[model samples]
Target: MPSQPPIPPLLSPYLSTAPSASLTLLTSTLGATSNWLILRFICAALKNTSSEDGSTKGDNEATTVVLVSWLRDATFWKDGGRKLGINFQKVHIIDALTTGLGIGASSLADVETEILKAITTAKPTTRVEGEERVLLVLDGLDFLLAATSCSTLETLDLVGELREHVYTTLLTSAADLPLTQSPTTPLEISHTALIMTMVHQARLVMSAKSLDTGVARDVSGVLRICKGAGAGDKAQEGEGELEEREFLYFVGADGGVRVFERGA
Candidate 1:
């Protein structure tokens, strides 16, 4: 378990300053999913614990979060969130995993409507008082391609529209060999299109997978962070491109993650 912050130092900047109108893609293989990392993001975002780098914030300072999980139920997140002291009241979770999102283009539109409603529930009336910073998180949205009849382009459009209402967007999906290597099947092809298109739109790309060199006693997996196609378009004044980097991470039984440079 980590003794420091839940958000490892290596990832803090990107999480805090991911530009608006951008996306952050968390790609995971079957052997190493990004659910654990997503939780850390949620923990930092909701309760947030601290921005002083050492101190904490009052309830009023919390960031509004809209979570849409297509692969896990409400119980799974609530239970895990409890471990991290997440304030569930501040988080709006849309659980599409338990039931179903239906099975066609119209169904996809209905799904989109539900997501928009959840995002704006707090201040549906206005942005006049001030702009609210709401983060939108979608876990396993790729599941839609396989479960429904929607095309990849249509699903991507849904993501684009959702980004309009939120402060930032982060999503997780499969990036296994078949999908990333050279997808050939219809589903794989669509899934690959979804991921690659996102890469072109995401400012930060965080991918997790087992060590290619095989098993290790201390390391469970590796993480790679790199700027995506979207990063270049949104570079702020004096802020240059982020250096590409990698780290080895170990997840403890207690569910804390420790990330560090290799050979550290």
Candidate 2:
């Protein structure tokens, strides 16, 4: 186990906080996966679930995570969670990769059904006092578009429907240059459209990609966090837009991730 906590102090504000009724978008690449960052979101949200004496907190401070993945298995996330001292078994999992959502018109519906089912039948530990806010994490949703023939709009509708059941929704997808900049094929077009639409709807957008200066012993990649189109709706009465921030992060051999501002 690593000595450091999963949620770094500098990254806590952005990783731990998820506004209610908002969407957060996480963009990653094959070279710089966001799995590490996603785990921090889980840790931070559930951090206040219990007090020092192991007593359950009220609904106001509790959070439950429901993870649905199309590109990875439950074990992959669970094992990672363990390294962070988190019990990922408590996280509701919808394994699209294993069960297969299938192709065509009904795929999106099936996706939505699975997610709602998970939330409906979650364990008691996940529901504090009465109702605990759920953070629905959808990993690799773009894979659904490429694997199935569902249009971007249909998949997006599924997103909206899922949001109605959870406090907030976090989505992850590949945003490589080809998919976002030079999309030409049908699959690419749909993937790009879906990502673009989500960006406009998301309150926070965090993008992870490899460093342009190449790999280094102390640096893993660069992470960019910015407010989205929906952010302005929640801004203070006289406040300006939220500032976009960037950081450099490194993942250690012991599965501990360190996220810090540039040059720190």
Candidate 3:
């Protein structure tokens, strides 16, 4: 198969964080779709190896991506993953929405428990070395907000709990290795850097929404980094801050996601 296209440079910074689970809140208009963006992110994460130049060096361990989706089924992701040239096996899909089948969660707490269990089990333990990074993709928070019948505060609390669980794991087992055995590339260093360098933890949170006024073919939409947990201080020194940035992107005829600065 041909090599997958590189993610647009504008979006690369979001996914280049040290290996750790993180929560990204994706808020979009009722009809606008963010599935393509999620798929693109998965492709980018899986394609990242120890090589900073985007080449395969050393052992090319495939990243494990567990997608807990409340909006779609396994087949939907399997097809999308194939189109992106990503190994479908690396993408695990869990179905959390069951209203259409007439069987739904009995309570909001039950739903929260199920989600937490799925994420906790998906996290890789540090007992083994050279384990690939894991990326947890929660596809539809809006669906959960609606289906659970929970108050806004209650739902937000659940999100907070999920975030804590997802973002606190070992970035990479390589961090435990001796200096003589450390890898040198930026990507490798980010994972296996010294304990001092490991203090900061960053993760990408992207949100997409449709333009209030736009023709169907135009497909105008907004994309922005909600916030990456440990990125604020680092970003302030140079890139301003992640939360202050936003972009305009659209879906193309070929199913590719193209992004452009909102006002540039």
Best candidate, TM-score: 1
Per-residue lDDT over 62-147 for candidate 2, one digit per residue giving the tens place of the 0 to 100 score: 56789888888888888888887666645787777777754454467777777888887652343346456888999988898888
Q: TM-scores for all candidates?
A: 0.90, 0.88, 0.64
Alpha-carbon lDDT of model 3:
0.54
Per-model RMSD to reference: 2.6, 3.8, 13.6
Error of 3 at 136 (Å): 2.2
- The Cα error of candidate 1 at residue 175, in Å, is 0.3
Off by over 4 Å in 3: 1-6, 18-21, 49-62, 98-105, 124-132, 168-205, 216-219, 226-244, 261-264
**lDDT by residue for model 3 over 1-264, one digit each (tens)?**
223354655766654443444444344444556777677667766675544544323322436666767677877777776777776656666775543221263566765677666665655555565453567666554344444444445645555566565542222111223321465754333333322232233344455666657654545577766554555545544534344468887676566666778556
lDDT of 3 at 20: 43
For model 3 the TM-score comes to 0.64
Q: Which stretches of candidate 1 lie over 4 Å from their true place?
A: 1-4, 47-62, 102-106, 123-128, 237-241
Candidate 2: clashing residue pairs, number: 0
lDDT tens digits, residue span 23-93, model 1: 88999998888888888777666544446451335442536778898888989888877776778887888
Candidate 2, residue 183: how far the Cα is off, in Å:
1.8
What is the descending TM-score order?
1, 2, 3
- Output the lDDT of residue 188, model 2: 87
